[model samples]
Target: MSKDLLTVSLDVYLGADPVLCEIVPNSSCGDVDSEDLEKQPKRSRKASVKSEDISRSSASSRARHDPVSVLVKGGVAVDPSLEEPLRSNAHVLSELDTVWHVMLNQTNISMNSNKFYLIQLLKSDTEDKYWVFIRWGRVGYRGQTSLTSYENKLEEAKKFFCDKFLAKTCNEWSNRSSFEAHPGKYAIVATKFEVPTKKEEVCKPEPEVLQVSRLDWRVQSLIGLITNLQKMEEDVLQLEYDASKFPLGNLTREQIEEGYRCLKDIENAINTKKFDAVFRDSVNRYYTCIPHDFGFRAPPLIKTQEDFKKELLLLETLKDIEVSYKVLRSARESKDNRAHVDRFYDKMHCQLHPLERDNDEFKVSMVSMYLSLGHGLTHMFSMEIVNVYSVYKEDEYRRFKGSIGNSMLLWHGSRVSNFYNILSHGLRIAPPEVPLTGYMFGKGVYFADVATKSGNYCHPSNGKCALLMLSEVALGESQVLYDANYTADKLEQGKNSTIGMGRKDGVRVPLGPLEDCGGDGGRYSLLYNEYIVYDVTQIRSRYVVEFNFRL
Candidate 1:
């Protein structure tokens, strides 16, 4: 099989970085020769050989000179005729040298400005479209070339760009509205080209186009901004990192802060303003800045080998995850007459409270254990098989999983609501949530888990548990109404108003201590507070559970 790729289509996924890009004949960018490419596997094998063999013998290689490497001191670039100063066909390959060359020739600025620098996700509200800044990279950009009119005809162009430049499918996400545009400080300039391959051979290139969408003006604007910002950010970061090598650590803190202020002043002077409100012309001006390396030519846009190494690690991790998913899928499909498919779940390794423990390991244990309880899979054994087959790409499935744990630990879901409100009730045990979705797994409240979401949490240890807990909540607030630290063994199962009766510490607390006083069950929001509101409409027989609060 061929190796998987770390696509530099529009943005980076899983922290993977670009090792090299080539400006080939067609609209496509063949993969780089980085070692990390070997990490992930793909369905196709020798897919690149057909193209590379012809490329090595062709005049194109002679024309571009080096095929595998470049002698760029700053950033990589191509011939004006070969590169198309307006839009460099992305087939050409170059090294970090090209970025350095741009800085050396473009500006006369020092980069050691003192100040606190930070990296933040560009919001749709930001006027900037570029997520990247390149230095010695390609000097020009591909603009709105999707030949679609202002009407819905943009679909053809959109598909073309997806296949050529982005490789993105429109209907893949639940939040289809997310791809829509917003005002931003950055600008993007890109295009998509389709170089159809002859049936017998797939190695040749034939056509090129910009990645812009023809559907709506807003879509066009968004694509443009993404391209522009990517190029610009690549350049800016290249210079910034390079400057660090010649650190003037001897400079006083005040001097550093002063330098930072000066840099901010420069930024303010760079025609920076809100863009989502305005249109067209402003975006064009932004494109002009793509090749401008801060107007300050430098010693060199420096980079360390370590940066690439980290990128390799991320790529490898992605490969591992993909492999695991495949294995799990195969096992799942092999259903037999047996009631359930069983797999080993370790216990002894987790039970030991090791002396020479680590922090990450500790975090994993706490979270894993907590999530395990949600599924009613609590005991620490070497391994055990259980009924957890419904692992697909569904939010309800995850909700079900988390609910399973809550039911195991607390008898039933604390409060019944829609999928979102239910998950929000916090039966999960994950890490922090930077975004509601699409981020590293953080501490979470589960009872809403079935391995959905763009990201997930993995234990840092070889095997460990993560703790999950909920506490009594007051249902008065709008958001989270309750949190209880109920545990196993201490959990008292209840059947209607007769809950927790006769058990040692089990006193039947009214479902709604405020509204119904000594109430029956209907709809109740048990926020993590004393004030409970119970509305009993129709009381039916269902199971209730409570947990041990022992630390």
Candidate 2:
């Protein structure tokens, strides 16, 4: 990392009396030796280095020939080549020079200006002569070179010139005497400032391009405008800070306000108009002011680039949606819209099929649903073992341990007519609709009818109904059967007793309830307990089942 830098003002030196050392032609300047420079008081590291190098070399070189005329301006070496008139390539001043480059209003000192004054001593590299260089111009500008050589009384002549320059440049001072009268009129203020690295040092990443199809032109223009405005804001802030550090730059608060005004105008333009209408050439001039490479790899610009990319993607998606709508409208109006509309619809359906298909089906909690209804497995069937033999090459049939004929029998399924409707209506507990045609021989007919009829039984309050059927085939059957011996006694009693006759079994039994019954015997069991279903649906069935059994 680099060391910290300090900013100083040029006015601070104006009050100091010019030192007039007699200049002897062909004679060297009695600059301080290295030992003396190291002893001198200093604040900047670069300044100390310059002073040390010059002091160390001047003494020994001076002893060999005529001592060189050395002048230390702001603790830096006086290289005439580095100053104006010679086009010096050397890094003229140390990075630590505390020169306050100022811009002065030639007509008024109180007002801000861009005109600055600079003075330097130069030694001729080709000719054995010395010259003084003085200039007044804008900062970062090389207006013209003005040179004056001092052959005799050089130091005195240079002092007179310096005094005259300060008097003319500063509007407050009419002459050298007035400046001396009020030395404190101009105060020196110091502040922190950063010197940006050279452009070559900064890494530049590849520029990102947004490929928005329909609105590419509009989006690109808006992005370009936003980018330029953002850069202008940064530049203005830098100039403001620079002005504070160097009073001569004449960077005032007014200039900063102007920059903010420029940014606001661009923002207003973006918000008020459609992006397509923001293509004014005058506003486009901001593009020229921005750096081409933009240092996209830099931290500040990285976030800026990402924001632009996101905006581009959003615009692109919006454009796609709009185009899709247009295409749909055109398809509706055209007669031969099969190619365009049908293909589009097909592609859309394909994309949406996964979400819509079987979405109504859900895991059926048979345990919870059955328990809520006070119903459960009526019988747990035990498996019966059967032996089989296989005939091979031998005539006699012999049973082998590995090749025994085995038969697996699945149980007959039971159907609860109204219960199926409730479960099928709620998707949370409904299983996938199963094909009942070949599920279990003739048992599937009743199961298939229940599954189809349940669709209309959906109740809104209770979400979707789930199927109470299990995934695997049931392998059990109920064992409730009517006794043949009791049937003869029931028949004899039915023929002799009247409608109100009490049964001989002790308890009085009602007879008219089943008197008009049509005998269509399939399967039946006497219910021993009452069953109850919760209020998840409107109907809360709680009644004693006359004859119910799971088979």
Candidate 3:
């Protein structure tokens, strides 16, 4: 096997960072002078090898001078002759009707590594030339690049590309849809790349007709709170995560799974009440697995259970943020220089219809009921309903309707940054890999009867806005719990969900007309009533309410 192929397999699949080394030609492979190699920097040595390869393989004078057609910063493989700017080749590829790109990642905590490999097949617009571009390195580093040109031989370039992919991943490119990872091979990373739309083809939605004009003047002030793109953008950006720190702008599935394991270990240590050296080590390992940009300051250690709980919540938010950031990054690649939020909004799979304050009776009722539920500490944060959007998610509703029986609308809230994925995929049940300790009612989709109870989950503070979803939860047969049950997924026969009873009840009952919870009204120690459904199919998203919190 060639050294390059071996290196690709190890670096790409084994989660090892690509080592910067000189690529010696086959002729001089066995006769390397250690002293001479020591005299030159590794980069200079690689450049010289690349130059030699180009000069020896090509007859063209232009190819000899501008030897390596390396992938530049923006993932664009520019032929020096074309002299194109360092933007994406997405549009150019679209015009050629040939866009082939794949991302692969492998992160192993045991190996202490996180790595990514990006490969693309580019066809030159000016000629019948083709280039197979490969970039591989550590997750946060620019790493290395190599480009191979097939002059007027597209078939040869394609075969070479597919062969390289097989060699690295042990999976055929054509059969990628059913891709099964070999014991030690790179996992395919799914990414959404948007093709640049022509300005004429872009169909911007027409502005909504004002319903307030037809309403009484007394209710005109409520119209000001309707969500616009600008306000949504402001609220979403408040997450303030440093995407630059994460070159991929998201964590790999493997990395996220590893994070769960790390958190589970920390959770065990916390439960044991052991703040020993081993506990400290576990904390450090968690941070390493899930990197956080704490700026210049060192990350604080999780010395308390409260701190651990906060970390768990942070991990949950980070998982959702990853989805939103990935979409935003792909949006950044488009030629359109529009605001990131506008681009992100255009990429959502589900439709969001803004509800008018004056015309939408449902919105008015929801707002009134939400305010009425504020009792005790829930009333501390003065809530203002900014916008209410009817979520038209057909797929989630289809799956939810499959399960028959008692269904009631309840509240679910999350960070504003998470809305992109939540709207796209609807509410999700926690993955089996996630630690049970991360949730109070085990791994399930949680909802609240009281709007303010779920509102607290938004982590709302003064001058900031948050998002809440009123979802229709199908509780076929309920298991009412007065305390935390980590293994609540083991529902009693015929029970579809778990309802955690609280000491205090909501001012009003559930919004929709649904069957009664056939169980006795036994009280729990929880401050708020929480409903947890183990299956994602039991939840249908209804309205997304955006609200501001004031002290």
Which lDDT values do the candidates have, in the order given? 0.21, 0.23, 0.55
TM-scores of the candidates in the order shown? 0.18, 0.19, 0.56
TM-score of 3: 0.56
Tens-place lDDT digits, model 3, residues 1-551:
23322111111111112233433222211211122112212221221113211111111110101122233322222222221331123112332223466666554333434445566666543345555655554343333355555556767767867886786679998888787765335666553334434422222224333221433232222222221323332332233222222323335556666667878887777788876766665665565455443322335566666767766776666676566566656765566555444455556656566677679986667655755554336347766876677777778867775456888777887766566678767788777667677577788889877777777777768977677888888888899888888888888998889988776555434443212333454545576678898888888887877778887
Best-to-worst ranking by TM-score: 3, 2, 1
What is candidate 2's TM-score against the reference?
0.19
Candidate 2 or 1, higher TM-score:
2
Poorly placed runs, candidate 3 (over 4 Å): 1-244, 247-250, 274-278, 293-298, 328-347, 374-379, 507-523
Best candidate (score: lDDT): 3
Best-performing candidate as measured by TM-score: 3
- What candidate 2 gets wrong by more than 4 Å, as runs, is 1-74, 77-114, 124-128, 138-144, 151-153, 169-237, 240-551
Residue 5 alpha-carbon offset, candidate 3, angstroms: 42
- What's the CA error at residue 212 for candidate 3, in Å? 25
Clashes of each: 130, 20, 0
The alpha-carbon root-mean-square deviation between model 1 and the true structure, to one decimal in Å, is: 24.7
